[model samples]
Structures are given as C-alpha cells and as structure tokens.
Target: TELQEIAPKEFEGRIKRQGVVNALDDEDFAAAVRETGRKKLIIAGVTNDVCTVYPTLTALQLGYDVQVVADAGGSPTKMADDIAIRRMENAGATITSTVQLLAELAENWTSERGGKIIPFVMGLMPQQ
Candidate 1:
C-alpha cells in the first residue's frame, strides 16, 4: 500500500512481492522477473550488504544484467557499503548512481523521454 501510494500511477500495477533478504529466493518474486522477459534489471534495496548484494549476485548467476543503484541503498557503515559494492562488482553487477542510470535509459536529452527524465533528475540534485 505504501509502495503503491509512492509509486507513479503507471508502475503501481507492476508486480511486487515481500520476500527473503535474497529476492531471488522467493518463488513469486523470481517468477515475476522471469515473466517480464527482460534481460536487464535495475535494483535498489534498504541495505546494500544484505538486501542488495544477495539478490544481485543471484540475478547475475541467473543470466540477467543487474545494475545496483549505489546511492539508493545503504549499509550499517561505510566499510560495509564499500565491501558490498565491491562484492557485487566482482560478481558482475554494474554499480551505478541514480543519475547515471537515468542518463543511460534516456539516451538523448532532446528526446521526449529524456526531456521528462531530465527535469525529474535535475530536481534530485542538491541546491548550490
């Protein structure tokens, strides 16, 4: 309910599931991903070490391209975050920032999709 409230209307109908620390371990979550027929997955979680890393590694093994949004996930400490990020990188998950991910997705700033995304991303920047 909270997610539906916060998510954009278009994504409110997307499949969502509460699962174990490793999302791939949950049958429904894994199934939903497979149903999408997508090879690439962009993921963020409450914590990088436990919540993000586990599923990222598993997803890589399952032959999906996984990108972890570094700033979107947290860890108990900087050391923990660093190690988790390194671990995921070593296992072949691309570690990206929210802005970088958006740019990659949008591709061209003059495009209609880019025009929409650029404003949203710019809003996320810190004021000078």
Candidate 2:
C-alpha cells in the first residue's frame, strides 16, 4: 500500500493513517483533513493518551468539531484512556461511538444509501 512506501518498513500495517505524521504536531494531517473540507472529525488511535488526544486537541484548536471514538482509541490501560477522554471532553471534543456516527450519516433506514449503510452498520453492531 501507499502507506507502506511512505512509512518505514517497521511500521507495516500497524499504522492507522489519515495522513502521514512523524511527530506530535502534524501539519500534514491537519491539511489533509482540511482538504477534505470536513469540519467535523472522528478521531481514534492505538494509544489514546498521546496519539488521539494530541490531534483531537489540535483539531479543536483549529475550529473543527471533533468526535473521539472512545472504544476505537485504545490505550495501554483503561485509566489512561479515561483520562484522555476526559481531557478531550474538557477541550470541547465530543466522545462518541462508531455506531452513533454511522447512524447520523445514514439517517433513515429506508433511503437508498441507508440500504447499503444498514448492512455495514449491522456488521459493526451486534444483534440486539
């Protein structure tokens, strides 16, 4: 993949890339998000404390509406993740679930896009 070329071979598939950033301050990532013309962002990362919080704070500072998917943003410990979530919330980032975001985008179940989206959403969600 393109990421394998840009990122070091050591990274391999472990890198979850929205855009390439080798540092905590990621101008390229911010620019990439801006290029998409998307003001609202859903942020997740392997280590929630540093990886997720840094970008979420940056996006919030840049006047973007940010949502941090708590479950998706894993941490070394639950305490660390909780702390990061609290910090993000304090900085005006919304803590949300993947399901909530998908539901918002999909809207009604009867719509054309909804037909496709529902199945995908169902796969993400457990039978209830």
Candidate 3:
C-alpha cells in the first residue's frame, strides 16, 4: 500500500489493519467518527473493491462527511481504479486528489497554515 511505502513500518502504527472489517460497514463508520471525537477523517487503502467501498459507504451512512484521497489511495489496475471511483462517486462520496486534500486541510491561503505549507507543496511538485 502507498501508506506503507510512504512510511514503512510506521503505517501500522496508525492503521487498524483488520484487512477490511464489518465495523467499517455502512452504519459503523458513523458510530466510529462520533466515538473518536474527530469530525475530520481521511479514508484510504488499496484495492478499491473492499478497502475503498466498504469504508466510504460506511462513513457516508454515518453522516460524517468524507474526503477520499484518490491519488493517495489506488486500486490494483487502472480499470479497477476507475470502477472504484465511479462506484463510490455514485454512492455520494466526493473523490479528491492528494493535493486537494492538502489545500482543503490548509483551508485558506492567507492564514498561518497556508504560509507554512508552501514548502511542503514545493517538495511535492515535480522539478521543472
């Protein structure tokens, strides 16, 4: 998974790797958000089949708005990826790019978060 690639050995620290769960099924993701005390959540994983669909569907069912980082999360094949995106989108999930998430998290360009984020953006940008 990309998360593992990004931070090898550290990914498991934050992920509850049950390898997909009934807890992530439609009604449960909502209860999870309420229980965790955080309105904001970032959902991502491999294989759009279960990882993306189950949790996204669950999160939406729970009334917790979700921001799915499509670029950060991907499926096994291009077709599988496209299908997953379309399926989730039809289910009212809003798909987003990795950069979009950073921008959204920052929320405003004139604030302190924005000022502090330029370097991170610069690092992510490809060399011209």
Best by TM-score: 1
Q: Residues 3-108, candidate 1, lDDT per residue (tens digit)? A: 5666778476665666577988988788988998999999898999999999999999999999999999899999999999999999999999999999998999
Q: Per-model C-alpha lDDT, please? A: 0.90, 0.78, 0.71
Clashing pairs in 1: none
lDDT of 3 by residue, 16-128 (tens): 53434534643444454577887556777655665767778777776767767787767778898998788878888888886787887788877999878766777788998
Clash totals in order: 0, 0, 0
RMSD of each: 2.1, 5.8, 4.1
TM-score for each candidate, following the candidate numbering:
0.89, 0.75, 0.72
lDDT of 3: 0.71
TM-score of 3: 0.72
Candidate 2 lDDT at 113 equals: 75
Runs in model 2 deviating more than 4 A are 1-24
Off by over 4 Å in 1: 1-3, 6-19
For candidate 2, the TM-score is: 0.75
Selected candidate, larger TM-score, 1 vs 3: 1
